[model samples]
Target chain A: MAAPESGDGNNGAARMVTLISSDNTRFEVEAAAASLSQTLQLTILDGGGGGGDGIPLPNVDSATLSKVLEYCIKHAPAAANGGAPNATAVDRAELERFDNEFVNIDQSVLYSLIMAAHNLEIEGLQSLVAKKVADMIKGKSPMEIRRTLGFPDPTPEEQAEMNAHMLEYGWAYE
Target chain B: MSGTIGVTLEQSRSRTAGPVLPENHVVSEILVRLSAKALLRCRAVCHSWHRRTSEAAFLLVHHRRQPSLPLVTFLAAASSSQSQHSHASLDTLDLRLPPLIGVGWTPLPRLADAALYLHGSSGECHILRCKRRRYGDHGLTTNAPAYHVLTIGSSAEPRRIELASNAPRASTWWFRCSERPGILLHGCLHWALHSSPEKLLMVFDTVTESFRSMPSPITGTQERTQLLEMDNTLAISWMDMCETTMRLWLLQDYETGVWTLSRRIIFPVTEMRSVLNVKWCRFYGTVVSQERYVLLHDSHSSYLFHCDGEGKLVRKFCWSGAVPRPAGHIGSQRASSGMSSSEGNMVLVRGDNHVSFKASRV
Candidate 1:
């Protein structure tokens, strides 16, 4: 569905685009925010996702798409200003606070976001989610990390292998 | 609503099993952000994880992502009770963490009755010890020297290598003289050997476990010469005792042994006049922190002299109070040997009988 007025004609008004989630949910967002995704940037530049023609992201679900859009919207302005060199300390601090809170989500949602971010080629989102995953895995043993990442318990052979590895790299545990 | 939206809205969501396993590339991207110690532990995660983490390409990526802090190892005088023959122990200082608490001192196998000579590069230390054996004219042994290399942190026991064949004949005094610490660059440990009429650079390649000699960048008799690594290149700073002039030379090309004169500084005779007033007073200058600082030690005291990239002295301060003295020997010999990493964050100091390690930033 298209908006009644074409905001593309006016330079003052922010350009808008429609994104279709994998679950077929339609969401409207500003073109600047959507452009943060390298994959969508080229399509948007080529006049795709204009008016009512929504860009379909087949790899991302509606919930994950919404979360990604939230990040893009918040980061777009600062990213446009080239990391906001002139931005006040409070503004930069607020953005950092927002980023810290954004990644604080359920493990399943975080995994979905990582997959979505990778598929969409969103550099910032990919790094952020990847860092979150790394933090969770930090200081955790192999088994603990496997469980944290939702991997199934090791089989007998795999358990034996892990035991051998632990014995060989015993200093790592220390 | 005007333009057509091509995709038809699905009323029901597609059911999926669970979170898909991330691709190896994605996993690598995440793992690269981890610290070296963390990644070492991560090798036990699984077969694929272990293989991926240990790959040379992945290790290079990890090193670039998280550059390792310099590790300093030196020889310290071992306690008398530890061994009846050997006099020294090995100590390691991990500059990546905080000082004092981060320093680890391990008592290695005894040096026996031999004199210990040490040089370290790339966090590995090569220690050479020699004992002279005397032989009488009638087939009785009196004094002949045998050299051995003490391998630290290796699985195998320390073995003896032929020192007479490997060592250059011109610099035989290198074993007896007190010299500056070795500068490690390009996988080779370099130390300046000053022997009266000739000066030679002793290069030990860690990969090949061999020793080679390169001509000194400066020829003729120079009072003091020190080897240092600057911007991944080998650099030498030598002071002419007669003229009290210091010159810094950088090895521009390693293959042809091409050296470019970087800087030359004339000592402020008026400022150092009081300190150098005595006839026997000898001043030793060593490049401590690459091109930033040079440690100058006189017979009685030591001072940290700040210098520019051009080797010009900017300012000087008495460093006796600031520099922590080595644990064992304090006043026996004035000659002190120390080396700093390329980044200058880590420093290892060796005195006559003691060794001290320090890090500026954690």
Candidate 2:
């Protein structure tokens, strides 16, 4: 495990905030980075999550919280530029590449990230995760989808329905 | 990242009979991103997915996002073991979408045998298939082959009604009814009662699974009238290429059945003609876009002319012998060129034993 840093004083005296995950793990992150979450933006605006009182995020676990923070930190610079209207194509492409890599984790961790992203009201993250999931299931056959999403073997009635569905839309079966 | 990267070991997709990934947020978010074909496949996953995708509000939202791309329908003949007589089936090749992407054809295997005419979309693809050894001399149905309406991917099979074999008047319809390809408009497949302008337009309403006649336009149909959908309205283009002029009429308001002569296109005789005495093949077809850009190509598909709504020539796009096989990829190239037209069109390139065409509303 990599040692956790006190954010390494990268910004000298920039405002830092602490977040407490559901498991009571405290994470210290830059205020601007944490503000990417609409849920946290307001509390951070009122000078909250400063000094000792960390924002309590009961819906997110430490792992998901760390993942979300990493994304926020990476994206905060671009967001601070007001949707980066002046940002070069290379910069946007770099961010896109990072984002593609960020979501390339295990399925369980990915689902948890989606839930955490949703709870935090991070619109970009939610859409990114949703698109990833959509791409995974697109063009897949019913049985393949059932297995991919971990759906159990269909009961007799469900099997009949599946059969009927296959009969009707067999052209779509890939 | 290591400490809880192991979280997946206990609760990945391997975990069955537990909390599934999708909530309402995730389902709608994910489902909407899927294509129409993918969504239909996704509906078979489970009851929750099936019901969620089936919701009317969700369907409307999903449909709005779908690209109204045109499809190339090719009539391919194949022998079916289910029936003694060889039959022809309507197969559509996707113009834009991937995998098939104009190159491959998605044949309707279920509706393969004896399927003659393909029409009526939106709710379901109503396939009109004929059965029994009851074909007239000119490859037309002498009487009825027992009209079996196969509603693809929707409700129960509509009751089969054999258009009473004893009815002799039905025999006159042998040319138009059984042979001529039906034009789809407003959820109905329409056929002219007679080739003459005086006859009423017969519509086989796919929704009600019944037949009804819509009165001819107030100005009456023009000679050699061909139905095409333009800007979401039914249009007829009367092309007597021999006279080097075409008349176009649009149904402004369908409820009132008002027909307005929109354009009178006069084709230039000097350009685009066959080597021998200006002979035009049946393979040549026309399509009008929502922007009113009219496209007509030669029988060889060698030249494509784009004309304005007023029948004035705008530009011309041509390619080498595109398809003695199946032609559709030209559409993408056509888009890249100027005049970005918006209606879906396909051309029916006649092959050895098959025929294909591009038209409005597929």
- Displacement of residue A72 (Cα, Å) in model 2 is 1.8
lDDT tens readout by residue for model 1, A49-124:
9887899987787888999999998888787776679889998999989989999998778877777787788999
Place model 2 in a CAPRI quality band: acceptable
User: In candidate 2, what are the lDDT values of residues B164-185, reduced to their tens digit?
Assistant: 3333244344222212335555
The DockQ values of the predictions, listed in order, are 0.22, 0.26
Error of 1 at B22 (Å): 3.2
Error of 1 at A76 (Å): 1.4
Q: Worst 10-residue stretch by lDDT in candidate 1 chain B? A: B325-334
Question: Relative to the unseen true structure, what is the C-alpha lDDT of residue A87 in candidate 2, on a scale of 0 to 100?
Answer: 92
| Predicted candidate 1 versus true structure: per-residue lDDT over B230-338, tens digit per residue | 7777777777865466788989998778889888776654456464455545555655453334444453443433344454656554422122111121111112123
The reply for model 2, stretches above 4 Å from the true place, is A1-14, B1-24, B71-362
Models 1 onward score TM values of: 0.55, 0.51
- The candidate maximizing TM-score is 1
Kindly report the root-mean-square deviation of model 2 from the true structure over all alpha carbons: 12.3
In angstroms and one decimal each, the interface RMSD of every candidate reads: 8.2, 5.3
What is candidate 2's CA lDDT for residue B269? 41
Give the best candidate by lDDT.
1
